[model samples]
Target: MKKFVLFSVVFLSLILVSILFAIFSFSLLFSQDSGVKEFEENFNIRLPRGTVSEKIYDDYSGFHNDGVKLYKFVFTPKGMKSFVSYIEKQKDWEKLPLSQSYQALIYGGEVKDFSGNVTGFGGFAKEVGLPKISSGYWKAIGDKSVITARFIDYENLDIKTLINLNSYDFYLAIYDTKKGILYMFHINT
Candidate 1:
C-alpha cells in the first residue's frame, strides 16, 4: 500500500510538473511578441509582412510562399553558436513539419525565465540599432533537399502574415559556419 501510494504520488507530480512547464513555456512564447523581439535582437533583419524587397531564393529547400519566396533563415551569434555546436556535434539535422518564421524561431529556444526570454537581459541583452534583416543564413541540406514549407523575400509585397507556433515541438540542428545566425523556412507539400 505504501509503495502504491508513493508511485501514484510520483506520477501525479510528474504530470503536474509537465503542465507547469507547458504553461510557462507558452506564456513565454505567446506573451507580448517575445519571439519577434528575440529575432530583432539576435539577427540584423526585419521580416515585416507586405514588404519584400529582395530577390528571395530557396533552391536548397524549395520553401516559398504564394507571392513572396522565402528560402534562408537568419541567425544570431548565440543562435549560430548553438546551431554550429549542435551540427558539429552531430553533423546531421532533422527537418520538421512547421512553417512560418515564428515557428522557426522556436528551434533554438532557451528555457529562460520571463527576463531571459524578454528582449533585454544580462547575457541575452536585446540587440539595438541593428539594420533590419537583410540576407539571412543559408544551408545546403543533403546537397539540395526539398524540405517542409515556403520562403519569401521580395523587393515589394506588403505581405502581412501572422505566424505563431502553438506547441513547442520544433527543433533545428546547430552549425558554426559562415552563416552566423540560423533561421529556417519550410518548403514542402
Candidate 2:
C-alpha cells in the first residue's frame, strides 16, 4: 500500500512539472518577436506579400569590430512590383538611375578605375550568400530592374569609395524583375 501511494505521488509530481514546463515554453514562444516581424522592425520596411524566400547574413569582424547585415529575398513578380511601389513612396529612398556599371554594384563584375584601368570589385549578392548567377546576368536584365538607395555617389561607384566610407549608414535595394529577386544590403561602419 505504501509503495503504491509513493508511486502515485511521484507520478503526479512529474505530471505537474511537465505541465508547468509546457506553459513556460509556450509563453516564451508566443511572446518573442518572430523573424519576419523583427526584420521589418530593423530595416524599417515590411516584406511584401508573397515573399517566398529569405536569407539573412550577419557578421561582426573581431579584428576591426565592423559588422554587416544583409538580407536577400525572392519575391513573386507581382510582389516585387508592390514592394518597389512601397519603397518609392518612402522619403528616405531615392531611385537610382541605371548607369552602365550598375550591374557591378550588386552582381560581381569587372570594375574600372577613374583612369579606365581594370580594378577588382566584389558584389553584395555574393557577400549575402545568395546563389551565384552567371556573369552579365544582371546586365542582360538591367532594363527591367530597379535600384534605390539612401545615398550613393552615382559617378564614383567604385571599390575605393566604398572602402573609404567611414561610420556611414548605407541602404541599398535592388529588384531583379526577371528573376523576381530582391536584395537589401546595409552597411554600418
| Candidate RMSDs in order | 19.3, 8.2
Supply the TM-score for candidate 2: 0.48
- Residue 54 CA error for candidate 2 (Å)? 2.9
Cα displacement (Å) at residue 109, model 2: 6.8
Give candidate 2's whole-model lDDT: 0.54
9-103 per-residue lDDT for model 1 (tens digits)? 99999999999999999998756443344333433334342221222333334334221123233444455455455444442232322223322
User: lDDT for every model?
Assistant: 0.33, 0.54
Per residue, candidate 2 scores C-alpha lDDT tens digits across 1-189 of: 999999999999999999999999999966633444544554556787656545478774634444556666766667777876776666544344334354565555776667667754465557777554332111111111113323555333445554444433344555554465665555544
Please report the TM-score between candidate 1 and the true structure: 0.23
Q: TM-scores, in order shown?
A: 0.23, 0.48
Clashing pairs in 2: none
Candidate 2 off by > 4 Å: 1-13, 16-21, 24-35, 48-53, 56-69, 74-82, 96-120, 127-163, 166-171, 186-189
- Candidate 1: stretches off by over 4 Å: 1-71, 94-176, 181-185
Give the distance in Å from residue 146's predicted Cα in candidate 1 to where it truly belongs: 13
